[model samples]
Target: MTELMRTTSATLSRLWTGSARHLTDDELTAVATGETVAQRTLAHLDQCQRCASSLVHAADAIDLLQEEASASFDKAYTTERHQAQRRRIGRRLATLVGTESPGKVIHFPFSGRPLPQLSARSGHWIAVASAASLVIGVSAGQLLHFHAAPAKPISSDGVAVTESAQTVPLTFDMTGTVKLPLLGDGLQHPAGEWSSLTLEEFDELMGNPAFFGNDDLALTNFLMSEFGSIDALTPHVSDLPVNIQ
Candidate 1:
């Protein structure tokens, strides 16, 4: 009977020693929270200072971790979301407005109408030229009508002087008659040997030769002129038959 009682006591001690080992973190958390846990585990905590200290340490560590995470999240939110808002917005807007997509062609937004493309210096020169031309035109217009207006006759003082006229007969006298030379034949002759040649003689020299020579059109023309001159020089016979050939 004493041996059997010793065996039963040994079994009970083994069960008591193993009860704490079997307890889970949930049961320990319950104990740490001051809530009820497994009956055996609660009893072990009440007696074993080691298990109770471990449970308190786990709970405190969990609380410390939670507080640290919360603080870190708040710091990050303040820095990123509020403090950098303007800068972030500026950067985003710059990227959106200035950045071009790949393979996109740039368009000239202001090219709907043609703008005068004069350079600054060229525009200045053109303005100067226009002004100078205008001035020159105006000056020329003024100069064209610059003639002085006719002066008004001055008023004369009263005068007693009288003018008289005398009548006289006028006699006219004639000078000797002048005759002009015929056409231009009387002018200075051309250079060379034909200086004294008459009109008819000068004509024969320009004609072709006679006989085995070519027909002389110039000679025929001279002969015709000689006949005409002879006719003109002949004096017509009057009824008195004066023989004035």
Candidate 2:
């Protein structure tokens, strides 16, 4: 370190001289020892402002170096400080644990377990799926109940309840007309009026004089003659009786 300082001193001296030529060894020694120098060297130094400024800067730098050296923390001081800190920490730890200071770091044995985390989007999908499943289950149950229900019996003439909540039966074809019996036989219903007692109400309706007049007698004769003709042609079971008179 002293060698480096000497080298810097020389370079600064040359800059102050304003020339590359170095100072004589005697002149350098005189300056170092603070002895009176030659009249020529003294005159030179007096005339050189650069050399004067350089010397003043060098003096300030030396003073800063002395202060730093005085303030330095040595290895022994550092070790002692660290040891004091450790003791203080241990005392605090001991107070907390109600135990003597172990003078060393303690190792814990806690196990590290990982659990699954659900993000906002994943949680939304799960909720949606659960709701959908519930709806599907309810719909399936309703469908099964509908399939297992018994058929409702149809009442012949009274208001009838049907699958579509209508009085009429549901049918695909609408092209043909249906014929229903509105008359009744004598045993089941009186000949003059409509009755619930008859299985054949259409026959009783046709026998009524208010509705049929003489047309029923003419229809009976026509039916008998047509049967006679059909029987003569087929030569089948005994001929239809001819008692139309």
Candidate 3:
């Protein structure tokens, strides 16, 4: 009977030592929040001063976190803040649409008839037809205005002259394919031969009188039109600085 009593006491001592271990942080948190924890953890917290102090700290931390969360939630969901945000959005939208004032409504006159809607295929075909028509129009214009090469005239020196010294057209025609040469066939003769010519021949050699007169008139008109007068375009002696020696 004494040996059996000693064996029972040893088993009880082993169980007590195992259950007396310190509580974990999770167990302490569960206990602080009133969540169901192991009975051994509760018993340990009641006796162990260190575990009790840790549990108090954990409970205080949880309370602080809960208070902060509640304050943040209340501030975020306040009616006044939401209303102010809505007012700002409305003002921005009003400014974007050029109203510059909130609560202003714009109404358009609606026709009784529904607007015509084109299908994707129909729209594509219309675009294609427009592009084809443009291409055909341009091609036709080029073909109609196409010109053959001008016949070259042979000069007295047997050199083929491509152009004649003639008065330029009053109105420039861009549609024409032919361009008049800037230096005409008049340069075919040597410079020495010009001095030997008669006054009548020299006059003929210097192109038409209309070409020179037209150039002078064009220059004068351009200066007057651009500057309001030739005096404004060309600086006078009085307008120049007197720094020169």
Query: Using TM-score as the measure, which candidate wins?
Result: 3
Off by over 4 Å in 2: 1-49, 72-163, 166-168, 171-245
lDDT of 3 by residue, 134-183 (tens): 99999998787676444444434322332222122223333322222232
Per-residue CA lDDT of model 2 for 20-133, tens digit only, reads: 443465665565456886655655556666554554565566678777776684634687798999989889988789787455665455434455678999999999999999
Better of 2 and 3 by TM-score: 3
**Best-first order by TM-score:** 3, 1, 2
TM-score of each prediction:
0.25, 0.22, 0.40
Best by lDDT: 3
Clashing pairs for model 2 are: 182-201, 182-202, 183-200, 183-201, 183-202, 183-203, 183-204, 184-200, 184-201, 184-204
Better of 1 and 2 by TM-score: 1
**C-alpha lDDT (0 to 100) for residue 24 of candidate 2:** 60
1-245: candidate 1 lDDT, tens digit per residue: 99999999977885866653645778777776678656778777777787878887988988899899999989878865775897777777776887633344667998667987789999899999999999999998878767554332221211111111011121222222221112122456432211233334423533424421232223223456555434333221111011111
Task: At residue 129, give the lDDT of candidate 2.
Answer: 100
- Over 4 Å off, model 3: 1-17, 79-139, 147-160, 164-245
